[model samples]
Target chain A: EAGVTQSPTHLIKTRGQQATLRCSPISGHTSVYWYQQALGLGLQFLLWYDEGEERNRGNFPPRFSGRQFPNYSSELNVNALELEDSALYLCASSLYRTKVAETQYFGPGTRLLVL
Target chain B: GIQVEQSPPDLILQEGANSTLRCNFSDSVNNLQWFHQNPWGQLINLFYIPSGTKQNGRLSATTVATERYSLLYISSSQTTDSGVYFCAVEQDFGNEKLTFGTGTRLTIIP
Candidate 1:
């Protein structure tokens, strides 16, 4: 089975602009999660989507939002991007309803550089 | 919110050596995961061990939920093991968001 896939391996956007990163979950997976890894920092949770609904979110601002499609693919949108927004955006997928201990497979991630 | 702490913030080892990394949480957690971030910035899942011990080749992990701690062991380490190892945990209730530790940065020399 194919692993989680993300588009735009590298992106460069100017400050105040908007950026959209995409992720495709593995086959048969129903939950998609978004995380941000700022340089020299640990991964921070951003959002969680399951069965086409937003199940939970982190302490991120409203400007950091995203949605999951019918096919379980997801899109993370960062509005009013700031230079501090430069980081690697990761997407992970897992089977819904499984035990919380189930491992989440991650994608290669999209590297966003806000100029 | 649960607090996750990782020990030995930094470590350096020669190739073929062995090492152990630890993570301690302040409260009970419903989930515990280990991830390795390579130089290219990919978060690779190493294990999702809430309890018990599991091994995958040279990498292995053990989570003693009752003790609120987990351990990751690397045996006969290789240059490919050089990176940052992160331990993340999710509480048993509420929003169930994953809280990450500061991570242990490891460098392996040839």
Candidate 2:
């Protein structure tokens, strides 16, 4: 089985620009999660999407948003990007099941450089 | 918000040596996992150990849920084991949002 996959291995953008990062979950997986690994900030939970709904989010600003499509793939959008927004954005997926803990598999992160 | 702390922050060991990394969470967690972030920036899932002990080849992990602590052991370490080890946890069962710890950077010298 193929693990999670992400597009645009590297991305370059300037201040005030918008950046979009995409992720395709593993087959038969129904949950997608977004995370940001920034300098000094460590890895943080950006957003969580399951069953086409936003389930949870972190303490990031409103400009950091994302959506999950009908096919379980996800897209993370950063609007009005700042220099601090430059980081390695990672995507993960898992088969959602209630009351049972499921393992999450991650993708090769998209390295975003905002100048 | 739950806080996850990992130690010793950095470790350097010989290829044949063994090492243990520790993670402590502030609250009760229903989901806990260990991940290795390679040099190429890929987070590889190492283990999904919420409780008890699980071993995979040269690597093993034990999570003491009652004490809210987890330990990852790497036996006969290899240069390929050089990377950042991260521990993440979910406080609730149904809500699966993970809170990651500040990783431990491991360097294996060959």
User: What local lDDT does model 1 show for residue A63?
Assistant: 96
lDDT tens readout by residue for model 1, B65-89: 9999999999999999999999998
Root-mean-square deviation of every model: 1.5, 0.8
**Fnat for model 1?**
0.62
Query: Between which residue pairs do clashes occur in model 1?
Result: none
Cα displacement (angstroms), candidate 2, residue B75, comes to: 0.8
Off by over 4 Å in 2: none
lDDT of 1 by residue, A1-115 (tens): 8999999999999999999999999999988999998977678889999889999998889999999999999999999999999999999998766444446788999999999
Which residue runs of candidate 1 sit more than 4 Å off their true CA positions?
A98-100, B93-96
The candidate that achieves the highest DockQ relative to the unseen native structure: 2
- List of clashing residue pairs for candidate 2: none
Q: Best by TM-score, which number? A: 2
